[model samples]
Target: MPHKVIFVLIDGLAWQVAHDCMGHLQGLCEAGRASLYRLNSALPSLSRPLYECLLTGVPPVDSGVVHNQITRLSTQTSLFHLARAARLTTAAASYHWISELYNRSPYLAVRDRFTDDPALPIQHGIFYHADSYPDDHLLLDGEYLRQRHDPDLLLIHSMNVDDAGHHAGYDSPQYRNAARRMDIFLSDHLPGWLDAGYQVIVTSDHGMNDDRSHGGILPEERQVPLFTLGSAFSHAPEVAVRQVELCGLAADLLGLSHDKPRNQELIRR
Candidate 1:
């Protein structure tokens, strides 16, 4: 059966921190309901660039989203576009940068923040501009979108963990607490998503550093975590997963044709 997917992008969450602090996800892995993999973020490891990479399967250098301030519509085809082309519905509760990339450019918060136009690549959206937007609110927005639209591909991007890492170091209590809080939120919502027949992939665009910033080559800045929870994935796969490959993986999960390379080892169907 073709699977509907809910992809949760937890911004700035590193492998170590996610491995340590996301106890609910970790418990799922321990119980064999999910699989965890180390994912290396695309080069330049910044939010906008990696976000493009995650959706387009194009590296930052190639996609021309080398920095966060580029603020324009994506030139490359994204997961949203591919899904829509395949006649699958798409929705997102994400940062405004996502709105800028896939839906519209120069996002007008007043008009674009809560979009539901079927003509758009993201057929439904609840976008936020602030980096400090609460993850709880974003998740709720995602759930609302899911229940209403029943999108085949739902993207939920939360920013609190990244915000906390920017305010405190990645090793600080605030950062860990942010991850823990998101874990609790996931604990609350994930079961419902799963029961609704949505295969879930929780991951991050990039990692965090002790300097409270990223865009560097440090492992802490490039090493993120990917947790796949659904029947479509292998219970144990040793394949190396890259951030760029996420687009293809998502496309594959949604039963769409994709040009990008997907880690087929990670899939059972």
Candidate 2:
């Protein structure tokens, strides 16, 4: 059987950071026989737009999610919709409300909502405190969901690294420390899932620049890392992929046909 898929998005993680902290992610790459490539985020390079692109397999222009605040509910369908349509159990855990904003949960389930309340708006769905890092929370929730419901697809988004990068700069000690923490979390907690039968795909929405800001169109702001581990990937490609393709990689990984016109140019056979 094809292993279940776990998509982990480490927010604001740059290629340089991934390389610098290779020791943390190296084992996953080697064990799962994965490849590494640079993927470009959407224009403007914000979190919401890039994530919406990831979910809907559409560009920011097509998805109608250009900024972090504009909630485009009726624009396009998300990966969750496709997964649900296929009758696959799906779960999502994130540190930011943007994930919930783009991928809304049903009325009965828990929801993470954006708020100025500082308490981290929880409309019902498993909402972690905004003041705290939700990486471990998301991982534990994923494990719980897997054990109790055996969800076929799980999505996790960690934001501490991004927060640290934004506040302390990309190359600061805080940023590296946060990355290291994420490394430890993955190494210690996620290997069991891989052993049990799961294909883990770790990537980022976008990379941080030298000044730690990324709402612009630049190489650093665009290029992100892609690491696939488990039974779903081929031999690791030795060459670096320079093309600015984001949704194409995702579509390929999920075994979905690329329908978006812009992604047609980015798709690699």
Candidate 3:
């Protein structure tokens, strides 16, 4: 059965913090409405690289998007490409990096802020350049895109958690509050999304550290939380999931073709 997918990527949310602070998501798991799993992020644990890794299932070394400074369109086929190839509509309310990766390169704010070209991989987009952009606003941006285009695949990427983690240490109150805030926002939207028959996958690109940095192998930086709310998933929380498997999982949920490996244990027969 094919279903619409809404992927919420909360940037810089550590496993511990997300498990502890995101009570709404935890409650969903407890109530048997969602499944939770711990995922080991891709190598180096950097944002840009992991973003590419999660979307393409290709490591940074192979994708040539090893560092954040690499400002060019991705060479590898991504989830967006797969969705578009399948003739599915796609939209993203995300950071500029996403636009640069799948749509265009060297993002020009005025021209690229809002895009609606059906010819592109991401057929619709509302991209943001500031890290401090509010999570609530970003979610609404995604909602707007959804209401307008009704895309089969919609991406909502929030940045406040990552910004808070950078401004304060990952252990700081601000960082925790950011995750909590996002959870509250999700609570407001998840119910509607579920009722509307949209399968949702919420996860992060990478985690942050107590030193206000990442790009390391520390548990705080390498481990992240994955929560799946959909009928296609098993309501079992103990699945061994990995960051790169997300692309295939989404593709599977949407009935799209993907060459990447997925965690079959996580899906219900």
Candidate 4:
């Protein structure tokens, strides 16, 4: 099947929250429409570390993205880097740090930061707006770029849920409302993607506590949901897998041929 994957990273979404806020997710699991598993995030359970882990298939000890404290991570063997190396198109709707990570690649990176830099190499597609963008904004912006640019691998990172979690507590109605908003985006988009030979992978980087803070080894912070749904794995049954294994699964989805030395090391870790 000719299939591509659009992986959506919902920040600070817990598995427990999925059943509560994202009822669509629970419906998918119960109806066997998707394989939903509780996967563990990398320790520290911070955003940057989990993102690096998802992209590089590396651990905090090696990547040095131990926390938000660490600034830049010269990650050369990540998904974007590998996609560029193999001549595949890439697109993302994310913040400045993520755009900076794609500086070397000819990517359709839409920087959704507060500051707008008109001189950025990739200008036409860049989105420099306020920090008040809702959770569904990521999906809407990503859908725009994918329809316009048709990137082979697309990433849309939603930030509002995490923000709500931090400000209004993880279990607060505000956080649930944000997840519900994203649910509408998924409902409207995912089924069409499935029919059109596209994989829709939705998961979170970490989970927040009731108190609305993260950055520890607590189970609430360390475990999140992982779903692989599309024509690529339509007949695949549900199974338990490591969080890092997702990196390999993504490469396989993209038909990426060469695994860099660092990726090879991922197999052993």
Highest lDDT scorer: 1
What are the runs in model 1 whose C-alpha is more than 4 Å off? Answer: none
lDDT of 3: 0.92
lDDT of 4 by residue, 162-201 (tens): 8888898876898888888878778888876677677777
> Model 2 scores what on Cα lDDT?
0.64
Instruction: Please list all clashing residue pairs in model 4, or write none if there are none.
Output: none
**Candidate 3: segments with Cα more than 4 A from true spot:** none
Indicate the TM-score of model 1. Answer: 0.98
lDDT of 3 by residue, 49-108 (tens): 988998888888888888899999999899999999999999999999999999999999
Per-residue alpha-carbon lDDT of candidate 2 for residues 1-269, written as tens digits (9 for 90 to 100)? 33467788888887778767757677656654565666667687888788877766677787677887775453666665655565556665665454455444322223343221212122112434363566666677656656765666667778887888888876688877877788888877666877877767788888777687888877777877877666556644554542234434444555654453233222234
Model 2: lDDT of residue 165: 83
**Which 10 consecutive residues of model 2 have the lowest summed lDDT?**
115-124
lDDT: the better of candidates 2 and 4: 4
Give stretches of model 4 more than 4 Å off.
104-131, 234-238, 258-269
Two-way lDDT contest, 3 vs 4, winner = 3
lDDT of 4 at 254: 81
Task: Return the lDDT, model 2, position 19.
Answer: 64
lDDT for each candidate structure: 0.92, 0.64, 0.92, 0.68
**Count of backbone collisions in candidate 4:** 0
Number of backbone clashes in candidate 2 = 3
